[model samples]
Target: MTHMSMSYLSLIVVTMVIGMGASWYVNRQINKYLHVPASMRVTGAQMAEMMLAANGVHGVQVYRGGPQQDHFDPRNNSITLDPDAFGGTSITAIATACHEAGHAIQFAQGYAPMKIRGALVPAVNFASNAWVFLLMFGIFMQLSGLTTLAIVMYAVVVLFQLVTLPVEFDASRRGLAYLKTQGISQAEQGGAYSVLRACALTYVAAALTSILQLLWLLQSRDE
Candidate 1:
């Protein structure tokens, strides 16, 4: 292989390693934070209600969504807490619920950045899931005509990831500030920071991987 090709290959490998390691590290820390609760006392649902009321934005609802994962749906004005978050009352749970609540507040207040981020969601979802296949298929067909198209599609994925960075970061910042203002849990062991930071890392890793993959795709764009 040419030196140029080899250099691109090495960069891809390095970025992938960083991306995967960041994800794994963050997940492990979130789980560890769940276990080391400064306050397992506040249930996620209860915390949601409290924060919502504190925010003075009524008519929104909080409910357990089901197993595994949890999130907020702005369109419905609902906070979806997972079984772990809703029932476990771990520090992780409370912080997570609060994070969702932050989204709700963003929606209610008509936060411009949140609106921009939300607008990108469908495109982001499509780019992340579909554009990859399209790129590979174009390559497999040896369609030089489609190479630039593929890169452009994947570039959308990278842009979406970039947009997501501010959205997730802002959510966590709002959530953490709420926790601190309310004095929800004692500062150090509160795990509020830990949970929020872990969540941030997930977004960071995702953004990094998307950018890395976009670079790889560009380098492979056929001659």
Candidate 2:
């Protein structure tokens, strides 16, 4: 391959390494805090409900499930928490639960970024699933137009990843702010912050990796 190709490949590799490292670090940090119970002794589900009610965000349901499967589904206006986070009264559980609750609050408040991200979801899914196939077909057929179209589709996927960063960060910010103002003590606030911040870093890393991948794809197309 050309020197430029190798350089782009190196950039992708470096970003992947960094992203993986951040993911590992954040998971470790979360596990560390998971064993330390919150001072208020509230389960993750209760904390989520409390935060949503405090924010005047109504009609959102919180459900318990497996670990690391916690997410706020805007479609159903529901929040699903992992077993550990839902049933555990730890700082990690409360912090994550509140973060998901923050998403519900954003939905109720009609947060612009979240709305944009939600709108892009279907397009992003299509782009993610079809881009590689299109690219391969283009290459096999030696069709530059098809290749360009594939690149455009992949770019949409990257845009989705970029837009997700703000939504995630805003949710964490709202969650942390709510925890501080609510019953969370100063010491507990610090712990919650650490957990939320660590979680946010994973999103940041993901965005960076996606951006780098897009850059690499563009460079390769040029070559």
Candidate 3:
């Protein structure tokens, strides 16, 4: 491999290792915190209900949204929690539920960053899928113009990740801030923050990986 290719390979390997580590750690944390018997012990559902009510919000249904990739869907105005997050009393469950709720809150308040991110989702999805074909086709044919278009498309992915930074950060911030004021004990607050931060780290890692890949593409533009 050329020096640049080797550098990219090394960076990608590093990013993957770090990402997997973060995923494992965050998953462990979420599972561990899913059953903590706290002072004001309540199920995730009850807490979600209480929290929403406290904010005088209604019609935002809470559902046991299946397994694996459970998330709150704003379009439906529902907080769909995972099986554990929907029923467990763990810190992970609570924090994740609240994080989803934070998104709901953002949707309700029409947070500009969140709105912009939502708008970009469709375009990014299309670009992400088409980018590789564009790049490969350009390389095989040695078409500089096609290659440039592919690079620009790849850059959209980076832009999407960068735009995502504020959306994720604000959600975590909102969740943590709300958790602090919603009668969570100091100890629980710390644990919740840990869970949220761990989750946030995964995003940061992904963004960094995209950035490095984009830079590598830029460095290859002269080829």
Candidate 4:
């Protein structure tokens, strides 16, 4: 195999390792706190509704999503939680629900980063899927212009991931702060923080992997 092929293969392996490790850590944290009931003992849905009301964020609905699916949709002003998080009173559930609630607050308050990230979604969706195909075809056809364009497209995906970091970290911060103010025990807060932190690492891992992949693409061009 060519040196270029070997280098790319090595990067792929490294990125895969990062992704897998992040996934494992997140799952481990989830399992560790999954059954540890919160002192509040409020259901995840109840916690989310209370958070929304406390923040004066009205008209946003909380709904149950599929397994492992938890997110706040700004488009519809809704928070969706999976079964475990929707009704369970565990630390994991409360943390996840409150974290998503933080996003709702961001939306209501017009957080600049969140707004920018939302604006980029459509273009990022298109670019992320198209870039790899464009890069491969460009290289096969010896078209430098197409290859450069492909790199630019992938850069958008990387930018989105980087923008995501602050948004996520801020959400976790808000969630934790709210927990503290609400008198959640310090030990419970620690467990909740662990869950949120592990989840945030997944985004960091993804961003790092994208950056390395983009760098590899750039390096291969000069080779």
Candidate 2 residues lying further than 4 Å off, grouped into runs, are 2-12
Candidate 3 lDDT, 77-103, residue by residue in tens: 888887887887778777887787777
Error of 4 at 211 (Å): 0.4
What is the model-wide C-alpha lDDT for candidate 4? 0.94
Model 1: worst 10 consecutive residues (lDDT sum)? 181-190
Clashes of 4: 0
1-223 in candidate 4: lDDT tens per residue? Answer: 3998899889989999999999999999999999999999999999988888888889989999999999998879999999999999999999999999999999999999999999999999999899999998998999999999999999999999999999999999998988898898889999999999999999999999999999988888777
Candidates in order, TM-scores: namely 0.84, 0.94, 0.92, 0.98
Winner of 3 and 4 under TM-score: 4
lDDT of each: 0.76, 0.89, 0.80, 0.94
lDDT of 1 by residue, 14-64 (tens): 877887888787788678767655443778888888888898988888887
lDDT of 2 by residue, 1-223 (tens): 6787679769968997998899898988898899998988889999999999888888998998776899999889899999999999999999999999999998999999999998999998899999989998998999989989998998898888888888988999999998887777888888888898888888888778877877777877787
Q: Which stretches of candidate 4 lie over 4 Å from their true place?
A: none
TM-score leaderboard ranking: 4, 2, 3, 1
**Model 1: what TM-score?**
0.84
